[model samples]
Target: MLPALALAVAVTVTAPPAAHARTGPAPSAAKASKTAKFPPGFLWGVATSGFQGEGSFPDSNWTRYVKRKATGISDPYEKSVDFLHRYPGDIKLARNLGANVFRTSIEWARIEPRPGVRDPKAIAYYDDLIRRIRAAGMRPMITLDHWVYPGWVADQGAWDNPKTQADWLRNARFIVDRYKHQGVIWITFNEASAYMYKELTMRPMDLGQLAAMRTAIVKTHRAAYDMIHKIDPGAPVSTNVAYGTALNGIFDAALFNEVTDKIDFIGIDYYYGANAENLTAGYALTGEFWKIDPEPEGLYYVLKSYQRRLPKLPVYVVENGMSTDNGKPRPDGYTRSDHLRDHIYWIQRAMADGVKMIGYNYWSLTDNYEWGSYRPRFGLYTVDALTDPSLARRPTDAVATYRSIIANRGVPSGYVPVRRPGWCSVEDPVATCFGTTPTPPAAYRIPAR
Candidate 1:
């Protein structure tokens, strides 16, 4: 195992080079004519979270954070996309897109509201959701926690209190016991490192307390992993990692390295990648997520790095998507379909290189409350929950593109990416600068799975 590094701002990006220098790989004199296909049984899906999508405000850490008027950076917590009431329609949307898997969370704050008092109605809501997803011919991927805890848990010293873990497990056991038979994949925690980073930076805490909190999270993950296995031994389980740009190793040290052994498959959530000359990642320092550019090829390095590190585990891209401000076209002019195609191209490349790639899930099925704002939109189906009264699901251009990709088993061989690879991608500096760019195979076409 690698030694843990100091926790810095999550965006510890390296210096970027001049923009003109990195236009992507120079065109090869020769080009391949056949497109490669993903392996048989490769899972394709869309992802959503309970607190982000479920509306009608629940009392929890996030709701409290948004309510604190002193935080000028916060946005008003109006009802989110209302997935709580409209999930049936949404599940149908996912099925229409040819998705084989559907990922969403069981909001801890909602399911077990008010400490030791599990809400029957909340349980019934999820029971129906699981059934609906299966009815649509998609398997459910349920995340136990996605960074929100009951306000009551916050009062009990959050993760700082050891008793919180016990309370969490009691809730976990109940959830797993109920949904294990639905052929669900389990994510013990969503972006564990990001959860801790928010707790450490958004709130006050000493280094000692921070360390204790991390330990508690690992204990909880391991305990839940064991409990879920006891209930459904064949179920796949993991905690997704928010892959930091070139600084992923530094971020992994904060949490992932601790509970690696407990993971049945590696779950990666990749979003941004910084090029050598365009260290535009500096924008993240201001905490504006909309400012970051989408780096589709970065997903390749993320999978390759983990493939080398954890050779035995199959990898799943639990979350990957582009976020446009308010569902608008990017100033850089990248389209969602363009981003999706480029990313898929690289995913096929990685798999060909022997990575045990198993699945890929777009970050969301619909836009929801993104942390504190609705500005960073990362959905194939856009929902203006704040401005629109009806909360309609609007399909973006990527919808047809995704459905086509899923139907073909991948992008067609000989299909060129609309967005070329970034010049000097810091994703893997050595390879980006000195190695030959990988090209599609000329004669080999992957058969549709």
Candidate 2:
């Protein structure tokens, strides 16, 4: 989940008009044709986090936080989708999607439920999970940490504690050494920026504590990156950044700039887009993600920005998806299939524009506890986590669309995004609003409604 407060801050900051003056015409139709197809072996995958998708709650900071009535969570964390016991069936759903990569986090809380003791049962569970993923013909992309930590860490002042860095690296090194030979892609931390924002929201903290936490997070990631490379040698590792609108650079610089040399690739999670006219994004602050319009075209600008910043590193859309409130139909009638295709269309455009994009993962495989609520469903398969005791995984409209996409490598040759690019999109003001208007091939444009 992205921090809506960050988006609110981005809305107030705008680039100067002259800073992005167009110097030439947009790409020609002929150029688009040359890059319509995805390169061979592009990674098509689904993403889930340990705490968000997995059920059977363990003692963790999040579990404790949600217990407080003041948190105002819409629902209780009732064995969320029960992924702890049902991973095999979920893995089957991803396999049926033709996915080559299955991304999930190794829960620090579960692995080390206590201060220093490691649970063998937790280790065995993840061992089998990775084995199944590999046997099903997919590589496992493991996230070492995804915001939730052992309750012991929280009791010790969480990231603000100076001891937290060593403790984090201890668990991280163990996980890396255990799975180093398993053909795994590693993510050191999930949305490091959002994690910090969540800390601010979940609890009251002074600026000094926040700064300490930031420093500790950077040090922990740097150490973890070094340790993973030392153990695995050539495996790719990154800490994904949640893409904030105009404040993206600022938010990313908080941690990314500190360890730019440590990253093997750039992992980005993009959801909503904001522009001068698109104030609807404010709804995300209140957990109303569906009300915010989907802006698939903004993904193109996001990729282009990163390509310009880090020309050599491969970029991956580590997580991207739209959320509907409690699986309800969006008022705009934009189905999940439409959102998936439109986002892929923009990704193809980014690739055409020379961005070194290598992989894309839908946000999740099934609906689970999205932070504090199950209301925001961002899954290819919807699961009634609160109501259904069976916790059945029902396919949404995106299932067939994703299966065909992975099998075909991308959307068809003449595909255009269902959602057109907004005027002066804040995603990359210099590239969009202030610069030359991007024009798709005439064959790809759909008539305005």
In lDDT terms, which candidate is top?
2
Number of the top candidate by TM-score? 2
Model 1 TM-score, all chains together: 0.89
Q: What lDDT score belongs to each candidate, Candidate 1 first?
A: 0.78, 0.80
* Tens-place lDDT digits, model 1, residues 111-227: 877978889899899999999999999999999999889999999999889999999999999899998777899998888767776676555456667677777887899999999
RMSD values for the candidates in order, in angstroms, are: 6.1, 3.7
| C-alpha positional error of residue 51 in candidate 1 after TM-score superposition, expressed in Å | 0.4
Error of 1 at 297 (Å): 1.9
In candidate 2, stretches whose alpha carbon ends up further than 4 angstroms from where it belongs are 1-34, 70-72, 434-449
Q: Estimate each model's TM-score.
A: 0.89, 0.91
* Weakest ten-residue segment in model 2 by summed lDDT: 14-23
| Candidate 2 local lDDT, residue 8 | 31
TM-score of 2: 0.91
